[model samples]
Target: MVREPSDRSSGPEEQEGVGEQDGFQRLWTPHRMAYIKGENKPSGPGRDDGCPFCEIPKGTDEDGLVIRRGTAVFAVLNLYPYNSGHLMVCPYRHVADYAELDDAEALELARFTQRALAALRKASGAHGFNVGMNLGTVAGAGIAAHLHQHVVPRWGGDTNFMPVIGRTKVLPQLLRDTRALLAESWPED
Candidate 1:
């Protein structure tokens, strides 16, 4: 029921059917549909409302993709990463805003973030990093019920036509493998 563009001499503008050839091969990423449909996303602004950051620590490290755990905070790989080895440092307590962090939580969060960067560098040889928090829903926080700082690894020429023109990112490694590598590469206290 599908016809290639070469089947007809006419251009795409003249085609009329369900399978209209646009002259470009598609890179189907059906897995992205879960993210697009907001699966596993929290429904409310509470820990009891299925906050992933709150529940992640309860599971085993490998199951949760957690790289390192601190007294007040932990580092875990982002399920939908912007790049390979992209991880977030999150406080154990469920707090929506950065100002809500206490002295101990703040200190541990900072230390965990530093350790995340070091582990990423050692594990993947990341050239640079994009580190920051989205703050709130309006500020681009996917899970606005909990505060988390992202540490996205970047390399030279990492930004290419795939994400720019095609609106897709090509991650080379699996989340579990990346987590294990980062956990091993994490620095000592």
Candidate 2:
């Protein structure tokens, strides 16, 4: 004799604790709303339209997520980081192209990038780093109008199926917390 499937087994919702349990856990990150909403995006390349890089320096270091400040450049935590200690080294000038940087800015940019990596290593035990610049909008720069070099700290097994499958990056630490740690470990002078 043939039997029909039970009505209660129609879908996962009907099963006991089955709908909520797929053997995978989730980490809700509602704080990313500002980035998603483009809250601090520059209206134009000019500093007048409220460029984040320019405005950041005006605020307190902790409020700005700044880890270190140099003469011509500064290191700040990436608002939407690729990893826990992701940093962006940016020149104070609001120039879009790397070639536009003055010699002082250029030198400080490199110096800040190195310093950022060192601080990340000491503070977070980073095993590797991805440090580079995304030159333009077409090159994957989120803020193309302002030049910034990304220094993303990486560790073994840091990459997982989450980003590929869910289109989400899970950062274990908060930006402020990471900033404080890096700031504490920042190189003197």
Candidate 3:
């Protein structure tokens, strides 16, 4: 038998013996919906096919959350970060693999990674770091069309039950603010 939902008032107190209150409080994060829905993720593997790494370099530093711009690479904050100061060093050229990078690109990418570590340490007093690349989708690269190396800053006991059990990471600062701080802390060449 098909039963129709009653047209009763939906308020918590107004509900008739339904939706019993639990002790848990909701930490509603509506912003995560965009990521969950894959809103800006690339539709195809081409540079012109909605690749964020290609598009990010075209905008101003502040708008793109870019910390430093080298000749062949740039450092930008991860839109969906694992930690507070997580950023990526990406080659300007939209190549999928690290082996595809030219000599200049590879050198600058390494230099930028070094600078990222220093800047993050100065800006946030990070105790440690998780730095590497997820080469492809199978390797856990979110945007596998472009080559980017992650520079995730870590502090002692940064991981907690929130991310383990609750499946949520609590970032204490905004991306823009973190960008500004890291940019200020970046070493001058």
Tens-digit lDDT string for candidate 1 (146-168): 99999999999999999999998
Q: How do the residues 1-189 of candidate 2 rate in per-residue lDDT, one tens digit apiece?
A: 333435334445435644533333455677888888888898887888889999999999999998888889999998888889888999888899999999989988988887888888899889999999999989988888999999998999888887878778877777888889899999886
* Pairs clashing within candidate 3: none
- CA RMSD of all predictions: 4.0, 5.3, 5.0
TM-scores vs. true structure, each candidate? 0.90, 0.83, 0.89
Ranking by TM-score: 1, 3, 2
lDDT for each candidate structure = 0.91, 0.85, 0.91
Best by TM-score: 1
| Model 3 residue 23 lDDT score | 37
To one decimal, what is the Cα RMSD in angstroms of model 3 from the true structure?
A: 5.0
lDDT of 3 at 80: 89
Model 3 reaches what TM-score against the true structure? 0.89
Report the error of model 1 at residue 19, Å.
Answer: 1.3
Clashes of 1: 0
